[model samples]
Target: MNGWNLAAAVLLGAGGTAALWGVTTGPPARRVIAQNMTTSAVCPALLLLSQGYGRPAYVDLALLLALLGPVGTLVFARLLSDDLSDGPPSARVLTWTAAGAGAAVVLAVCVAVGPGRALVKLLVTGALLIGGNIIASRALADGFQGVRGG
Candidate 1:
């Protein structure tokens, strides 16, 4: 336990240092964003590292988060872009589809590998369904409106 705690502390410290460097090199707004992301990454990693000592599941969670971190960050950046209204309809559809696919993949992986309950998996699936509806309904309605006007 002592060793695990020590390792976690060291990893967190290293992550903080990297975050500091990232912020210092980026623009003002970017610096803040980068710092926040780096910090988010670090806390999860440390939590997993610490939990790895008792439960291996945390290690798997950490691995998934590490793999998906960039995707989340990119989504955040896209949401904050200045020209959000100008993207092509096809491009928007592709983006939303890809995000949905990614979520599906994650849910599948968690179900297959983790020790979570059936209810949790069902909840995740339900959330994905809701999210998909929210995203696609807007575009679908817009297309319908366009056709009606024609």
Candidate 2:
């Protein structure tokens, strides 16, 4: 098969799985799911597409997208809160801890998928993250509300 065809398949697979995950998991988890799916699919596809086309621009674009990963995260946080806590350091710690934990899970999933199976791994990882995030986000929002007396 041609390289472009392969890349298209990978992107489609990832996007499809992610979309399915988002639909199944509900709103709380959709963003994380989408982010993971896109990154996982895009990264490996870019690598292949770059090689096939004999151009480095695809790689650059992939890297740029990866770096912009925080945008969805920030949006998620904003959705969870309209309040800035002033009461305790503990609450701040919990917030940071939750974010850190979520990131670590994604990184671990990516590594476990490995270089060769990156695309497949990305698709599954995105779906899993979306599922996990849906549950975790709700729990976090609830916990934070308790801590802040909201």
Candidate 3:
């Protein structure tokens, strides 16, 4: 009802719809990129919802998603490397754009939360989200050849 919830609803609805479409009906590489995008989109929306609902505890959901989303993406990248290796998608623009968005969202939340343990947690989550995103994108692009004993 409020702006935060409305924003979250819009993000979840629009972003999720796009991601689902991309993931469900695209080449393997495109699907991987879409899957990666879902994390960036949903995590921020969850943060907004937590604020909108005035539930600090709800932030935990966002935090966990920020932490685990990339792990899951990496798993997909690793497992599907062979499928992607043929033409490993190079989505540098998309990757950095998503990272920037994640950073912006985390900073916005941190500013709203003010300096404290919550701020530290938000910062950590932002770092993890961006760092993991970059790493996962690299893995997807390169087929993680280095990690694959190549």
Best by lDDT: 3
Tens-digit per-residue lDDT, 42-103, candidate 2: 54455455545755444455455444443454454445443323221122343344344435
RMSD of each: 10.5, 10.4, 1.6
lDDT of 3 at 27: 89
Winner by TM-score: 3
Give the TM-score ranking, best first. 3, 2, 1
Give the clashing residue pairs of candidate 1, or none: none
Question: Model 1, poorest ten-residue lDDT window?
Answer: 82-91
Structure candidate 2, residue pairs in collision: none
TM-score of 2: 0.43
List clashing residue pairs in candidate 3: none
Against the correct fold, how does model 3 do in TM-score?
0.92
Model 2, global lDDT: 0.45
> Counting only residues 3 or more apart in sequence or on different chains, how many pairs clash (N, Cα, C under 3 Å) in candidate 2?
0
* TM, every model: 0.37, 0.43, 0.92
